[model samples]
Target: MIPARLAAAALAAAALAVLPAAAARAEVEVDPTRYAALGDSYSSGTGTGDYFDETCLRSNRAYPQLLANGLGAELAFAACSGATTSDLLSKQLGSLDAETDLVTVTIGGNDIGWAEAVTACITPLTDCMDEIEASETLVEEHLPGLLDGAYGAITNRAPNAAVYVLGYPRLFNGERTCGALKQPNVAEQVRMNQAADRLAEVLQGKAEEHGFTYVDVRDAFAGHAICDDVAYLNGLTYPPAESYHPNEMGHLNGYYPALSRAIA
Candidate 1:
């Protein structure tokens, strides 16, 4: 009887151990009451074109709104159209606090004059490579410290939040240059994509260092670049602010899904 009882106790202990391991493999469900979307144009939905607040270009079609609505969480949308890392620290961080339990940010492009570089690429006689090379140098030299300051501020403000630092998508398909006038050629497009890749690499490292999840959307937007049949990003649009930004479908299909997969 003693031997039989001992075997039964050992079996029960093993079952308990197995249950925990099984639970660990299950999906992570983040149900936060206070969610803050803080960053630049990507989070603001600049290219989507249905802006409720023109100053910030906040759109209903943006990924933040979509994600917030999906999770049934109250959102403090603080992203603006032309925000840099410095802009994020000064203007956007106001939305986050200790009570905030979820935060998502996509920044750092504007810091290195990404838009200006694209403009130079599209201008008739300007040397695009020189401008792109300058931006790349800033990415290597200066953007890290700027990101560190912004990220540190976020962690400090939202101590309990599950923060996600989202990276930018590669804007070009790289096979064909399809836009109208003075568009980046195939070779230029390839280099631009390489710059995007470098930015993602930097963003991923900084995010991980700060104990936040880094969501890379390059893979998500792979076949959906500007020249693709079903392009997620805008290619030199009319209101130049919208140029090179993700359209509504991009937020829906690319950014939102990448973020969803990260937390889900």
Candidate 2:
């Protein structure tokens, strides 16, 4: 018979040997056969260049494309610029189906008039507070139902898919910088970030209700927000449409990796 000490040693060694295999199995495993990308401008990659077309403005550098490529999954790219939650229910849900194995979304910005608020906040002499306050009202009263409808539609369309709802980053680092274009003051930035936080909270709650994963990018974008030395988000740019949206690197380093970690 084996000695008690020898048996204990053998058991310890066996447990250690089993750990590495378990860790290997635990490594990021997203092998989607068919992926669907849904939601608004962020998902469509409006700020990132190299669009598939003017209609959807689906960029090659979008996180969805990067994720699909990384997983070697066939993608149904339905996200579009200027898309509202209503648009998701009406237009984007067509791309998803039971065959879709994975899905990702970034919506609610347009619904809350995020672009309009940002425009007011950054533009010289504009009373950004009014826009922000109005957005806050929408956030409290209107956004929940809108998000529910949109998320519900997504689940219905992709009943068997693993859905990921990605939230937007807070666009500012609570700093003020006077560059070629006007920047939102520290106060404006703080308020806007607060609004963004509220939006994210709403998005997360809805995503959770639907049994979908909600990936928050606020921490991922902490130092990379506008006014940072190396901003992943675009400051007021020429195209105007790209203003305040995540850049190519933001999608690559921020959104892509955030979603990757969530999937893992």
Candidate 3:
């Protein structure tokens, strides 16, 4: 038999010894193998300097890859670049199942003809505002129902998964730094950012309606937009098609941190 004080001390030591193992078990309970990534260009890492596939442009630097690596989650599926909500319903939903525990999506930009709006802004004689407003009308009228259907399909497919609907960042830094022919003016850039904000709001509302999380990247990319001194978004690339997409730093610094925090 030991002294009462000594016995109490020994019990305390035993409890301390059990804590680390219990914590480790808790960590393992997360099931890292069940993650699936789905979305459009930003999620696919379009302008991130490297590609896993030419057509998909899936970059190893994308936020999904980063989160998967950090959490030791198996990235079982990833579809991005050029994918719209309709595309997601037709093609990407096949990747999710009841086993899927984690998912991230960034879409709807393509659905509203975001690329066309950008082209209109850069084209010599096109009315950029008119084009943008037309796109906004689509967002207001058509996009909600489309998003709801997409979200329903996703949740139906991956019944147990935690779905995160990520939104795009503003592409401009409220400045007119690029060539007049290559980029929109400061006023137009502001309007573009506002449109992006409106889209994000719509996405957030849809996500809430479907029991999913909405991750906003606008603030993260504020100082790193196309016209910034150290821009994270590509500004009128040689091919010109790469303009306004997030580069490597944008995905890593701008996207990854925000996603990590949200999942945490």
Candidate 4:
């Protein structure tokens, strides 16, 4: 009964309305071809092996590279040894692409500069705990904001990318079995770990907000804890040449767990 012109117009209107619904219903494209990693020491395998460069910046042993290795994805690890959330955005990450299929980040460790802070307070566990605790106020104020921004930049830069934010591995000697190396107070380890937990939560929240994936490494490093049956770290007692970073075995333990969850 309707005129042909009116019928065409009605069909066009219906199409427009349906278009938005279809777009909303459309599944996100996830290709595991080209990938990139953005973050700091933990992801870069600082104490690990040669996954990338030569400097103290560490090597290709980085976990993100591990992820790439298993996924059969091409990788460009932009993860520096001491990267921050800000680094993820401002020329901070490199070799990225609009068509990148996957992206991962392991940032925020350097924000607290906990390595240096802990190194400075190594001789005084109570003081290190106190100093690290005081910095929480600052971390709470800024780390989330930085993560949110980093998430935005990552998604914006690569609209079709699948992003996965990784968490830091356990650093403290919970069982206090580092041989001659004095272990940190168990209470202090818990305190520092709480901060690390909060950091992972922040990154995970932002990743969820922006529709990216998150990989938590805490549980993965449990038995491999610095003082566990075997050891992951070389103990805080050794010089920079020996300690402060994950050993080769540490990277293997940390990387497989995180990469398994992400790639699977």
Compose the digit string of candidate 3's lDDT tens values, residues 38-127: 988888888885688778888888888888888667786567688989889988988898877788898899999788888877676556
Residue 117, model 4: lDDT of 54
* Tens digits of per-residue lDDT for model 1, 118-233: 88877765668988898899999999999889999998998878889999999998898776774788778888888989989999999999989999999999899998999999
lDDT of 2 by residue, 142-246 (tens): 999998888888778878778899999999998776567556888999999999998888889888998989999999999998889889999888687787889
Q: Runs in model 4 with CA error above 4 Å?
A: 1-32, 124-126, 177-181, 237-242
Would you estimate the TM-scores of all the predictions? Answer: 0.87, 0.87, 0.87, 0.78
Model 4 score (lDDT): 0.66
The true-versus-predicted C-alpha distance at residue 40 of model 1, in Å, is 0.4
lDDT per residue (tens digit) for residues 1-264 in model 4: 122322344465566666777674655433346778778777677776554475436566656666667765677877776666776677555566676767777777677657655664456533576667655655677777877787787777777666777776767755453545354667666677677677677767777877877787777777776667776765664336446666777677776566566655
lDDT of 1: 0.86
Residue 27, model 2: Cα distance from true site in angstroms: 22
Candidate 4, run of 10 with poorest lDDT: 1-10
Per-candidate RMSD, Å: 9.0, 8.6, 8.1, 10.7
TM-score of 4: 0.78
